[model samples]
Target: MRLLTRFCSSFPQQTTSVGARRGGINTHNTNRHYNSLNASSSSAADQVPVLDPSSLSPSLTRGIHVFNCPDEVGIVAKLSECIASKGGNILAAEIFVPHKKQTFYQRSEFIFNPANWPRAQMDEDFLKISTRFKAVRSVVRVPDLDPIHKIVVLASKQDHCLVDLLHGWQDGKLPVDIKCVISNHERGPNTHIMRFLERHGIPYHHLGTTKDDKREEGILNLVQDTDFLVLARYMQVLSANFLKAYGKDVINIHHGLLPSFKGGNPSKQAFEAGVKLIGATAHFVTKELDEGPIIEQMVDTVSHRDNLLTYVQKSQNLEKQCLAKAIKSYCQLRVLPYEQNRTVVF
Candidate 1:
């Protein structure tokens, strides 16, 4: 079965600007120019404020709970009632009902004194509610200083997206603990990407693949402990069985806007098609290649003057930006899967 079990959604809508950080350890300072806190009002009914992960503080943030079940009345009311009984304050909530499927999806955040609402007890109590609705649920307790999501990045020879993610983590831009970097390509021992990762003390693993190797077995072992997997332009095609085994939390950055230009050599395809707008899509990886639920998408206008090389360069930049944005949203607990093939990201 295709499971939609994942974390809650919605970051603060308002965030302070973060200037680009210069390279090298001497230039990096954690205190200089932190992003603004992404706190929301006490009521989930109010508009959600945007949150900058760099600006979060432990005293002000709340925990998010994601729940989905067969559509019926009082799911929200009952859940809210339970939370209220536990002295939890609803900070923000997003709910959706896919009419055709008769299913409900909800992501809600609440502030409660942990001393009063212990996680173990809360889970025990919530289980009854879940069973009553035949629900599937996940709770992500996000403390201000904690790295709630752990990521493992998969890359190939192309390191643009991988480099972007690494730098973002180092500069305190993306709110995730990068567990490690895995690459199918040997790329030799002295590649620039290897030197850069080693300079920053990030773990890098090279798993060279042969045509007959059981590559997926090794990958599965590596990612078993990770919360999510990121395909930072990894060129290998994974089988449907592999996707199912991995729990389907994998996020991939496609260089082309989906449904228009898909598969290899998208830039060349777009150039031949003479499309005016070129774009990138970030989505959950599924068995059906490039057809997974999309989390975020971005586009850039193209002109006749732009040749294939120029388009490639510009689209590479877009790929980095789009993937980073989607990763941030995923880590912030603001992405929700809904309506079979769609996602609702707040």
Candidate 2:
């Protein structure tokens, strides 16, 4: 994927008299960056260029692009040639191709001097290459150096998952802007957790549920300014209307293997069923409760001695890990919808 450029020009000259001319050129470079970073083709090798990063500006914009092609190795070489030729440098890349599938997939990040090269010309050049390779999909964006995605986390009483996410955001491990943290409980019995958010200058919304639709309404209002929602063990079941309103914009982490042990106290259910494995699943919220498409999952082995308490503790750990991964994927634009599931094109 290549970043395409859009340009705008303005003239400040009067057109009344023939000799009354006095206009200066005003140009605006509105370059739209493409995130799909992949290249293919037998002759693409001619496009790659070699560059020294030290020669470029310190504040360079970065972007990722992906391409789907069966034989991408040759294309990768060609793409490298193109970037090198244009004084652009590839920072990172990853490729994937299933054994039974004939198609190929690739994700690559690159740095370029937008001031000099601009996006429009780059897009045109990339389109020529894409046409030759018959690329499937492409996306491009300037990596958000400062808060990009606005996220609102909803939790019932659990603090482990929420706490981990908060820490990740504060430390810059997760690239997102956590607009607020909404809970059905008033900080529960854990005052330390409340202090943590306050210390970080992060706002907290404690709208305790009461009458009918109160919790739903509160959540809807809180998330009105947010781009995405994360249900970090937010125990209440969302109504059909809520699901329809948010749809794929909401992500939930369940303390169960999902499609198996769903609903209240999943750890207890797994223990009672004598299952050998207990796990956690992170997925998008749908009208069918835990039946939504999964984004990430983690499992842990259990023995007969493991009781409900032990299983719950283990599942909590798994939940924290899974939810964090899912959130990261969303911020990076790596997760894509694939039928009733997700395709994390990492």
> Which one is best on lDDT?
1
Clashes of each: 10, 28
lDDT of 1 by residue, 255-292 (tens): 77776677777888988888888899888888777877
Residue 32's C-alpha lDDT in candidate 2?
A: 15
Q: What is the C-alpha local distance difference test score of candidate 1?
A: 0.71
lDDT value, residue 334 of candidate 1: 68
User: Residue-wise lDDT of candidate 2 within 54-161, one digit each (tens)?
Assistant: 565776666556665544335666666666677777766654443344455556678977775577666776677677778765555556333487888888887889
**TM-score, per-candidate, Cα-based:** 0.76, 0.71
Worst 10 residues of 2 by lDDT: 1-10
- lDDT minimum window of 10 residues, candidate 1: 16-25
